[model samples]
Target: VAAGPAPPGTAPGGRRPWRQLALLSGLISMDSSESSVISVLFPALRAALGLPLSALGTLVAVGKLAGMVTGPLWVMLAQRVSRKTVLVISSGLWGVWSIAAGLSQNYVQLLILSTIAAAGFAGGGALVNGILADLFDDAHRGRAAGYLYAGVAVLLAVVGPLLGLLSEVHNGWRYGFFLSGAVTVAFGLLVAAFFRDPGVGAAENPGVGAAENPGVGAAEPHRGGPARPGATVLNRAVLRELMSSRTFRLILVQRFANTQLAMVSFGVVYLVDVFHFDNATASLVSAPAAICFLIGTALGGQIVDRVQRRLPDAGRLLTWQLATLGWGVAALLATQVTWPSIGIYVVLFCVLGVLQGFNPGCNRPILMAVTRPETRSAAFAVMLSAESAGWAASTLAIGYAGSAFGLRTAVLWLVVVLNLANALFMTLIHRPLRREALALRAATADTHPRTSGAENR
Candidate 1:
């Protein structure tokens, strides 16, 4: 078929958000699968190296700590440099480091190599998230984000077991890393060749080009476009603007508390150590639960979008946030019990997986709603840094606690308490999110009067 005319306002060669969503999804999948696949190799690693449980925890903690510093650094650099260039460089470098991690002869070598890889990997989250916001307008961002994150969950589900099978072979885990790294390096080249910038503020309001191109025949330039040059990386003005937003502050706190559920880091370990399942068996069972989670993500995204259309003023998104927490609570209860059959354990985990997946479809869209397009990347970077810190601390704590007590007790206590705290923190965002969302929409309409017609209403 002959190509259709480029969509209005899209750059000559730029791909539409939906079209690019799949490519970005592939990037996200490759970025995360390495970590997921590695988690499954923990048992083989321990057996081969004669390492302890604490070593695994230390690796996870140190890697996350590396991400905490590098996440924001990548965002700042992207603002000064460009998104596509930064992404390509970071992806290529990390791919090399990940392959090196597999060749480590000792625990110390592996830890150091993995942390260096993680610092490079940190660019993916904030940079990709910001690009996503520019691709889809406000109305479709919820579903768009859903499709992207569902890819991550699905990729992890597949690679987790494949790596487990590999771990059964002598020195097979090293080969798995080699394959993953090779795939990532190839993908990075593709991103550099094909991925478009989408330009900041490209999709703030549908049917409006003013946000992307200001000062066209107008008395004054529109304020809705991206930040101008000469603004320093993480300038004080941007920091103050972000800090002043109540919604931003509340979301940051919620993100920190929620990281306690970084259970995937130790989930396979949990099954192997406590439930007495082999690595392959645990991964096989977890795969179906991941599918259940993907289903929940699809349903959650559609339901929340419909609710937002119906009750934009009320805390509809917040209601879904609470619903997610309710699912977590149920999953926690299920895990706490000893079932007569392993099938029941699988069923409970599926429930937990589904519940866990519900939040991602809504969370990033919430952040986009409150912040300007220019600042969205920084916003994500800030949130990620805080989240990484939380994860690092929790991983260290759980590792030590599991050694002193047991994995079951440590996971149970931390998951239950932190989640309850997260639920309470979410309540504070209900009003602030509602208020900020209105302000953003109104500002977009005012800046782009062409879209202020009934099409926007």
Candidate 2:
């Protein structure tokens, strides 16, 4: 687990990082397939196990709860070992738990096994986002993140219906876990074999005189290097460092309030229960919606990059706020209104998907702009843990509320109202975000004066 130099051909700003990004996206997509199956195949699972609607919330909640603990633990482990090793074990080798979950004969067994699998999967987000920041500079991080997430959406779009079709077969829901686990294992091996660690802060200090490396000049000493044993441990100091940032604090609040993820997690169930669509027919909406999400990430990334360049102080935050507001509007229309056809629902969900895409494109880069490379993984770990906590709360609330007041009423209140509130709340971040970003830039310039001119350009 000793830290090593960057892999051959992985110099800062190299053209070769896209392959690494693709592999990271694939790992995430496969890791996520388990949840997709649960959401899509919940009806079959319920019928087979004789469970209640609230059980869906339990199933989803357990995984998120596990993430809240394991995400930060995994990041700490990566700091001690190497991100590559931690990723291989957490994302790749962890598939065995998924396979075990698939083989469960009852609800309790499935819940236990899925929780174990989720703990390992939780490790990837912090590590992946950390590596992504090191792979690309500020100027291109948006497009890179956009393409990364769009790749995930494309895979989900292709896989969603196929998972839906599994419902047609007896005991087919188990196969979804089996397939997801197998693919996850395969990709894990692929990552171990191919993914190169882009060394912390590599993007900030491109090699001197490398004409091919864009937006950077003269190399400085690498500030972020191999961690000494326990050096990167998540201590009170690390927590204090993260909490001290006004922008980071505001982002955490926004994460808690933004519960739109619960909407998609329950979309299939909503269609099945309220609209009375069968699993197969209901799952069809996942594809077009995913495609639109893909479009949003790809297109939104480019727009965010340009907008940030034009309005460096508030552009990305503004885009994120508007997107959140638009999502609330779409959620109200999609859930509260009685649309005539599934196609109409699909159209509305597509709008929601696109707006959702704008978020990661902006928020992630915002994080990168403010945090130090050495702390980025820890920063993302904390943010994702907050997100998981929010999702767990929102999904559980949705489940109980859906049972009492009908899903239509539950979703309209939880998804629409909270999203609008989150949008308004985002105004608090504009000044802090600008302030922190400038501070980070000034610090980086002081640390690597040779590259400051190129970074500013």
Best of the candidates, TM-score = 2
Give candidate 2's whole-model lDDT.
0.83
Please, what are the lDDT tens digits per residue for candidate 2 over residues 299-412? 999999999889988889999899999999998888878878889999998999999999879999999888887788889999999998898889989898988888888888
Question: What lDDT would each prediction earn against the true structure?
Answer: 0.71, 0.83
Model 2, total clashes: 0
Residue range with the least summed lDDT across 10 consecutive positions in model 1: 213-222
Error of 2 at 422 (Å): 0.6
- Give per-residue CA lDDT, model 1, range 250-354, as digits (tens): 878777777435676787777788878787777665677777777767777777666766776643466557765776686576546666666776787777777
Q: Candidate 1, clashing residue pairs?
A: none
Error of 2 at 94 (Å): 0.9
**Native-structure RMSD, model 1:** 4.9
